[model samples]
Target: MATGDTMQLVHQALRENSLFARLDAADLERVVQMASVRELAEGEALFHEGDLVEHTHVVADGLLRVYQVGPKGSRQLVLHMAGPPESIGEIAVLSERQHYPVTAEAALPSRVVRVPREGILQLMEERPRFTRALLRSVAERQFELLLLLRRVAFFEVQSRLAQYLLEQHATLGPGFPLPTNPELAALLGTVPEIVSRTLSRFYKQGWIRLEDRRVWLENEVTLIAVAKG
Candidate 1:
């Protein structure tokens, strides 16, 4: 597409995103002018942990996976799967942090709006509501991180897997497409083999049934009991 058309698309996306909804026409125009579009292929890295924070990104299309690689490169933990209209790296931008805390990779072919940090800071100064909204977004993400940490620290692999399955079922129904074992392992902070074994146990316990990529819940009450363990 033409550059003008691309900018128009980006502008419309920004307007639709709740984080940018409060901006007036002129402020929104400033943001569009300062923004650039980034297209990422599947499994491509957008930014790595410890990279200098420069642009605050918003996913305009497709999914981005936020993760952290362990010290010895032995493990990767999936922190978040961000989709359209979701802001990435906002915490670093808001906190004036120099580096990103997590790596962002494209889970699918993705398009992101890259807004310069200066432009975001300008918006915060001129738009009080925008600042509050950004802070709230950060706080919400922090709460989610806390909950995830609690689960990882206290829950067993089986319990965490059960909870994840139930949550996915609730959101996407019983026939939800389950993520691959490796992906689930990253999300649950375990290895793929353990994830596979847990799923097998679930199947044997009559808590869930898997066919191809789809998962069906056989007994939600029992799954919930397992999850609460």
Candidate 2:
């Protein structure tokens, strides 16, 4: 259960979320009554892949790293990073899943509101609007995952890397300090050596420049060509 200003803040954030956006204040309050705020220390795992499906959670505070294990079981293929007002594990619960499909870990000290599968089921029965909202949210997530799959399955690693760089450049601008090689590899679904080799090639071709652990986007036109391939 949440209390005081923290509870108020959580309510405000949830109000903005599409899942709860259509709900009236009274209905929203009822939803909160069925949820509990859980705090996770940095590196704590909210759930692991294959764990039995139990509860779904939404971020009340801080960041979550959603990922899957690679074939060797040592490497991680990062799926996405979700933050405040975002829901994780909701899909599994909605789908009546038996086990989790991925792992959710705390990227920072975080607070999340855990909502029981049973409780959501009850809410859906009572609130048609809430059910519609959840369906729409799930549909959007499915399409996003489809696009990611298309990129991973059809595009070459170099093309994906180029696209990732272009996206980060557009979002963060030039001279942005990049994640370590291994982290980049996890995100790009490749090995560190491959990521290093690709970046080196980019540098040699004058498409990008590296300095002091930061990247400079030197030629957008050429990088765009690589990304489109």
Candidate 3:
């Protein structure tokens, strides 16, 4: 029942994804043949916090925000983005848990392939190599999350903000427009006005030049000190 275009996109998504890279054409075709694509709308939740773990989804396009419900009845944003081939409910896959730990919401209109848990487990049982590769992917994600936790726990907001800016600058290149004050705040897990005040102080001290959303590191040494402190 899959359309030609849907099949093509699934193939393209799998091909680009590191997780599925090792799958031979025949295996990849089998996966595509078995998976189901589900469409989600903006602000719509794919799963509620504590929902039974039915399927693990891979974002084919758009974005997903993973969050938990706070005691105050607020949504505590955990991860702002989930892109293609990044699987959700991966931990559930390992533990054989019946429920998910957090709610997953579509940040924008999105398409995802929902792989049933039983099907995946069966595949892994039959293909040990595939299971090994999948575990590696999960471990990598765990390491990255640990680093994020360390940042939140040990670093002061200004220092964390500076380090994040430096990272973005490295990826986006120097002379690229720095992120706007608000965007920077979100990345640092803080608010815009506070970020503005901190950045303004740094700007006056000649540590950085912020024009728009781009940050140019005027003094790498000072910035490193800031990140460290």
Best-fitting candidate, measured by TM-score?
Answer: 1
Off by over 4 Å in 2: 171-177, 209-216
lDDT for model 2 comes to 0.85
Model 1: what TM-score? 0.95
Runs of candidate 1 with Cα error greater than 4 angstroms are: none
> 110-217, model 1: which lDDT tens digit per residue?
999999998888888988999998888888889989978989999999999989999999898879988789888999989999999999988998888999979999
lDDT of each: 0.89, 0.85, 0.76
Off by over 4 Å in 3: 175-187, 191-193, 199-215
Candidate 2, 21: how far from true, in Å?
2.0
Q: How far out, in Å, is residue 26 in model 2?
A: 0.3
Error of 3 at 11 (Å): 1.2
Each candidate: RMSD: 1.4, 2.5, 3.0
What is the TM-score (0 to 1) of candidate 2? 0.86
Model 1: how far residue 53 lies from native, Å? 0.7
Worst 10 residues of 1 by lDDT: 12-21
Candidate 1: Cα lDDT at 221:
94
User: Higher-lDDT candidate among 2 and 3?
Assistant: 2
